[model samples]
Target: MFLLLFVVAFALTVNSHSYHRNKYITSANFFSGTIYSWKSDVVGYFKLKERNNALAEENRRLRSLLAEARDTVPFIALDSTVFPGPYQYYPAKVINNSYSKTKNYLTLRKRIGDPIEADMGVISSKGIVGIVNKVSNKYASVQSILNTNSKINAKLKNSFHFGTLVWDTQEPNEAKLIDIPRQAPVVVGDTIVTDGKSTIFPRGILIGTIKDFNLSNNQDYYDVTVQLFNDMTNLHHVYIIENVEKEAIQEIEDVEVKAPLQNRPTESIEETNQENDAE
Candidate 1:
C-alpha cells in the first residue's frame, strides 16, 4: 500500500511536467523562438573555455612573431639591397606534415599570391623546411629535407670546409654531408649550418650537429652524419623565403652565358645550298 502511494505521487509529477511541456510546444512561434534563443545562448556558454584557449594560442603566436622581427635584422626589399648573396622571405604555416616515411613532405597554407614559387621556401623558426615544389591559389607543397631527393649546401660552423648535405637512408634525424675536406675537424658533436654558397637558405642557418664521422681510406673528405635541428616528425609553423633577386639572377645566367660552338660546324640546308651555288 505504501509503494502504491509513492508510485501515484511520481506519476502525478511526471504528468504535471508533461502538461507544461505540451503547452509550450503548442505556444505561438514567437514564444518558442525566444525560449530556443535562450537555450542556444546557454549552450554557447559551455564552449566558452575552448574558444578562449584557441584565441590565446593565436595571440601567443602573434607575439612570438613580433619578438622575432624585433630581434632579427630588418627585412630589406630586394630593390634596395645588393648581393653576391640574395635572400627573401615568404611566411607560411604547416597545414599538413609527415616525417616517419623514407619520403616526406610538408604542405603549406601559403599560395601563389604570397610570392612563393617553386624552389623558394625556407622555414623561419626551424631553419629550412624545403623548397616549394608546387603552388596553387592558396596552397603550396614542400619537399622536406628528410626526403631522399632533398639536398642542401652545408658547412662546418668552425671551419670553412663545406659539403653536400644528404640523407643516409637510415635515420630521419640524421643526414650525410659528403665532401668536407679530410682536414676538417669533424668531431662527434660539431655543429653544421647552411653554407652561404647557396642562395636557397641564409648563411649560418642551423642545419644540424655532427652525430658521427668516418673517413674512407682513399677519400678526400670525411663521411659525416648530422643530427638535424628541426624534428621533421612534428612541425607546426614555418617561414618561407623567396629570394627577390633569384629571378634576375636566373634571367642573367640563362641569357648572358652562351655555350661554345662545336669544333666542326654541321652544315645547315641554306649554308649547303649557298656553297653549292658559289661553286
Candidate 2:
C-alpha cells in the first residue's frame, strides 16, 4: 500500500510540473519529426527522376505559351482565320554533348514524329545553343556554338549594329563577334542577340553579353568578345525551333537568285557616246 501511494504521488508531481510535461512533449515531437523527415527524404529520392520529368514538361508548355504570346501578331485574313506563330517549338533531351573538341556537337533525343530537321535552331532557357545539322528518325545532331566553324549572325540588343558570332576554340563560354563596324557604340556588358537575318532563329534571341572589344586587323571592324549566358558544358533540356515558313521563304529567295535582270546594257553610256563622236 505504501509503494502504490508513492507511485501515485510521483506521477501527480511529474504531471503537475510544466517543465517536465513540456520536456516529454518536446522529446516525442523531435522523435516523430526525425522519422517523418527521413521518410520524406527517402520518398523524394525515389521520386526525383519523376519530378524532373514533370518539371521539364511544365517548362515546355510554359515556353510554348510564351512563344505564342510573344510572337503572335493578330491579322484578319479574307477567310477570317487567325494565324498562329510562325515558329514551332519541340522539347528534347540531350543525349550526348561534346565541348572539348574543335568542332563540338550535341546529340538530342526527340520524339519520332517531332518534325525535327537540319538547320533548325536549338536553344535553352537562357540563350542559344546551336543549329541542328543532322537528323535521323529519332535523333538530331546540333552544331554547337562552341565549335570553331560555327558562325551565327548576332547583334547588339540596344542597337542595330550586327556581326557574325564565332568561337575561337580557346574557351567554352566565350565567343567572338566579328565584322561589326568600328563606328558601333559597343560597350562592355552590352547584351548580344540574334539578328534574325536568317530563318534559323527569331530576332532578339539572347546570345551573350559583350566582354571586351578591340579593332580587327584591318582596323575596319571591331572584334567583340562575348561571354555566353548558357553554360555550354552543362546542358540537359533544350528546345528545337522550326520556322514554319522556312520553305516558302527559301523558295522565294531561290527564285530571286535565279531570275534574270531586265533592261541589261552591254556597253557603258560614256563609251557609246565616245564611239558616236568618233564615227
Candidate 3:
C-alpha cells in the first residue's frame, strides 16, 4: 500500500509540471529576446563610429579629385625627386569648427610631425574654408573666412575684377567681397573664385556665388554678398594646401617691400637751410 501511494504521488507531480511546461518555456523565450535586443543595440552603437570614419574618407577622396582636375599639371608622380608642383595638398579631418562667433575658427586633425604650418590654405570639396593660424604636432587651428578679421583675395570667375573677401558677422552662409570695381560685370548668380594673388590658394578655386551687390559707401567700388559653396555650419573633411615655395617667396617679397622704404631720398641740410632762409 505504501509503494502504491508513492507511485500515485509521483504521477501527480509529473502531470502538474507537464501542464505548466508551456508557461515555463514562454518565460525563458521572453528573457532570451530581451537579451538579444540589448545586444543588437550595443553592436549598432559601435557601427555608427565606423560609418562616420568611412564617410570622412570618401569625402577626402572626392575633394582630391576636384583638386586634381583644377591642377595645371594633373599628372604628377610624388615619388619624383624634383616636384614641379607649386602647391601640394594634404587631406585632413575637421575635428572642430565654429561658425556662430564673430571670430570663427576651425581645427583639423593632422598627424603628429606632419608638415602643416601656419598660413596654409584650407578648402573643402565645394569651396574655400579658411587659413591655418596655429599648428601643433597633431593638430592645427584655422582662421575661418567667416571671422571678422579674415580676408582672402577673390575675383569674378569670368572677369579680372578682384576684391578682398571679408565677413560681416551677420550670416554664416554669406560673406562680403569688397573693393570690386563697379565696372566689372556682376549678376546675382555670378561665381566668385580665388584670384591666385597670394600663395595660399591656386587661381580659379571656387569661392561662391554672388547673391547680391551694391556700391560701397563712397560709391567707388562694389560690395558684393557671396553665398559660399561649402556650408560653413557643416564641414567634415578639408584639404590643407602647402605652398612649397612660400618661405623663399615670402623672403623675396619682404625685401621688395622694404626696398622702397629704404630708398626714399633724405632732405639735404643745405636744402633745408635754403628753404628756411626763403621762408
Candidate 4:
C-alpha cells in the first residue's frame, strides 16, 4: 500500500511540472512575436535619423574639401612686373587637437597629396593655429600654438619689437610672449600680431592682446601674458598654409655657397706672419 501511494504522488508531480513548462513556453513565444512586430516598425524611424546624420556629416566634409581645392590651385595675382605665381590653399580639418595643457598638438587628415609638410603654418577664419610638424598623404600633424614646441614671431599692435608667442598650456585662451625688454613701454591692453618674419605666415595676423605680465626676478626680459585670438579647444575647420614661397626661401637660406671672405686664405696667413714677426 505504501508503494502504491508513492507511485501516485510521483505521477502527480511530473504532470504538474509539465503543465508549468508548457505554459511558460507559450507565453514567451506570444510576447516575442509582439516585440518583433513593434521593433520592425521602429527600426525604420531610427534608420532615417541615422541616415540624416550621416548626410550632414558628409556635407560638411565635402564643403571643406571644396575650399581646399580652390586654395591649392595655382593662382597668380594680376601683376605687370612679376612672373606668374602660385597662391595655393591646402584644405584640411582638425581631426584631433590638444589644448588647456602646458603642451598641445593638433592632428589633421591629409597626405603627401596635400603637399603640406613640416614648418608650414596653420590658420583659420578665426585666427592662427600653429605650424605643421609632420604630414602623410592621408593625415598631417600640427604643433599648435598652445604647444610648448610652438614658436613664432609676434609683435605689438604698432611696435616692431617682435619676440615669440608661445602657449603656456596652463590656460587655453592665453599664451606668453617672452624676451620683450622692460623698456618696450607696453601697456596692459596692447594687441599682438604675427610680425611676418618668416615666409610661412603673412604679417599683421592677429594673435592676442597683452592681458598683463610681469618681470621674473632674475630675467632681463618681461614675461607678457597674451590672450589668444582663437578658441583652440574647439577647432573644427583649418587651412594648412602652403606659403608657395616658403620652400624657395628656405632653400635659398640653406644654401652652403661659400661667401667671398673679407681676407683671402693666403692674405690672412701673410698678415698673421707679418704681425708675429713684428711682435
Prediction-by-prediction clash tally: 2, 0, 0, 11
> In terms of TM-score, how similar is model 4 to the real structure?
0.60
Q: Write the per-residue lDDT of candidate 2 for residues 1-279, one digit (tens) a residue.
A: 999999987876564332211222221133433454455456556657865885687689789987786678664344546556789999986666779877777877777799987789999877899988767666676788987667899999998888999999989999999999988999999999999878899998899999999999999999999999988987767899999999999998676445434334534644665686444
**Which stretches in model 1 have alpha-carbon errors above 4 Å?**
1-85, 251-279
Candidate 1 vs candidate 2: the TM-score winner is 2
- Candidate 3 has an lDDT of 0.78
| 1 against 3, candidate with superior TM-score | 3
1-279, model 3: which lDDT tens digit per residue? 999999988876564334222222221133433453455446546567755775687679879977887686766557768786899989876666789988777766665566987788999877899988766555667778988778899999998889999999999999999999878898999999999979899888889999999999999899999999988987766889999988898898787557556756633544674686444
* Ranking 1 against 2 by lDDT, winner: 2
Question: For candidate 1, lDDT tens digit of each residue in 180-212?
Answer: 888888888888988865566777888888888
List runs of model 2 lying over 4 Å from the truth. 1-81, 260-279
The list of candidate 3 runs beyond 4 A from truth reads 1-79, 265-279
Per-residue lDDT over 133-240 for candidate 4, one digit per residue giving the tens place of the 0 to 100 score: 655545666767886757788878777676778767688888899888766778888889888867878787788889998995677778899987787776556777
Task: State in Å the error of residue 268, model 4.
Answer: 16
Q: Give lDDT: candidate 3, residue 90.
A: 90
Model 4 bad stretches (over 4 Å):
1-87, 255-279
